[model samples]
Target: MTDTSIPRADESLDDEATTPVAVDEEIEEETDVDAEEANGAGREKKSPADSELFRQSEIAADYVEGLLDILDYDGDIDELVSAGRPVVEVVGGRLQSLVGQRGATLEALQELTRLAVFRQTGTPSRLLLDVGGYRATRRKELAAVARNAVEKVKEYGEAVRLDPMSAFERKCVHDVVNAIAGVESESEGVEPNRRIVVRPVD
Candidate 1:
């Protein structure tokens, strides 16, 4: 999950460093509206996509803040709008454990945060959550892996099976293959252990 609370393009690093967001009213209002539309069941919730995006960031920020406080980690939470999306970034010392090896911890955290957003909004959120810039780094690596798979498929004329990855990672690979010519990708198996298969375009 990439950071749902990303800073706007013009927001400087200094602003991010100094600003502190506690409960965004815009988000609370949007979530309240969604809750009303959900009708106590998982029914339709009419809300602007952007508002849903904001709620995701707000929920994620709350989750991360609680985690930091419990673990006794010191990091300032910076929330802002970036690239037409909300993003929350945590920067501080001794925080690498939150990222975990291969970003397993970060992925878990994202799922939990998403659940939190769903519970509050009564509707699923499309929020991208990121911590320690792990997703950004992983994206570059996944793109490379996708290209390599495509090359192998072209050279050997056989499908390529990639190691199981989280849903976000699979989506990245799928997106890469989907954008390329003469290749295709699809996910197979159950999640937390799902895999991706790349094949030649028919």
Candidate 2:
């Protein structure tokens, strides 16, 4: 049977890091209101959408399971809804191949899993897939990269442009830069070549 229980291993990584504090408060209040509405509407039962999201997660988990089996990989898959999105995490050793270099393969697999969910649900899914905590680890590393760029910009009083990065990586850097004082970041160039330029605040 599929393990639908959320693992505590993933909870330590906060998604709120990307969101501004004020916006996070607003989102929390909205979430509270939504929860109240859901509870009242369902009389303690889950709403249809909540049930559908769980189904999507299940489908995603199964699809990933099949892939792992075909690849002869060993891992434990956990599915859960987090931050209003379905997430599937595969935790195990030797999963670096799934993560690929800089998560390129992981991104591809996520897209495929999302497609599988959409095929079953007839609706596009925003499912997130992580292999061996690669994304969580990468997020921490990217934060440091952002901070280093910020330091350079602050010291030289000139913009520091970083190498091209995927959208997810760029967002990680952007969040870190946004949180720090006296520095700002913006994306320039096109896909596969798009990059972030960190500069001192005006």
TM-score of each: 0.70, 0.75
**Model 1: how far is 96 from its true place, Å?**
1.6
Q: List the candidate 2 regions with Cα displacement exceeding 4 Å.
A: 1-48
> Which numbered prediction scores highest in TM-score against the true structure?
2
Model 1, position 132: C-alpha lDDT score: 68
Location of the lowest summed lDDT over 10 successive residues in candidate 2: 21-30
| lDDT, model 1, position 81 | 38
Candidate 1 per-residue C-alpha lDDT over 55-167 given as tens digits, one digit per residue, 9 for 90 to 100: 66777787778778778999888654344445577877788888888777876665566555555655554455667666777877988999999999999999999999876
Clashing pairs in 2: none
lDDT of each: 0.66, 0.73
Question: lDDT score of model 2?
Answer: 0.73
TM-score of 2: 0.75
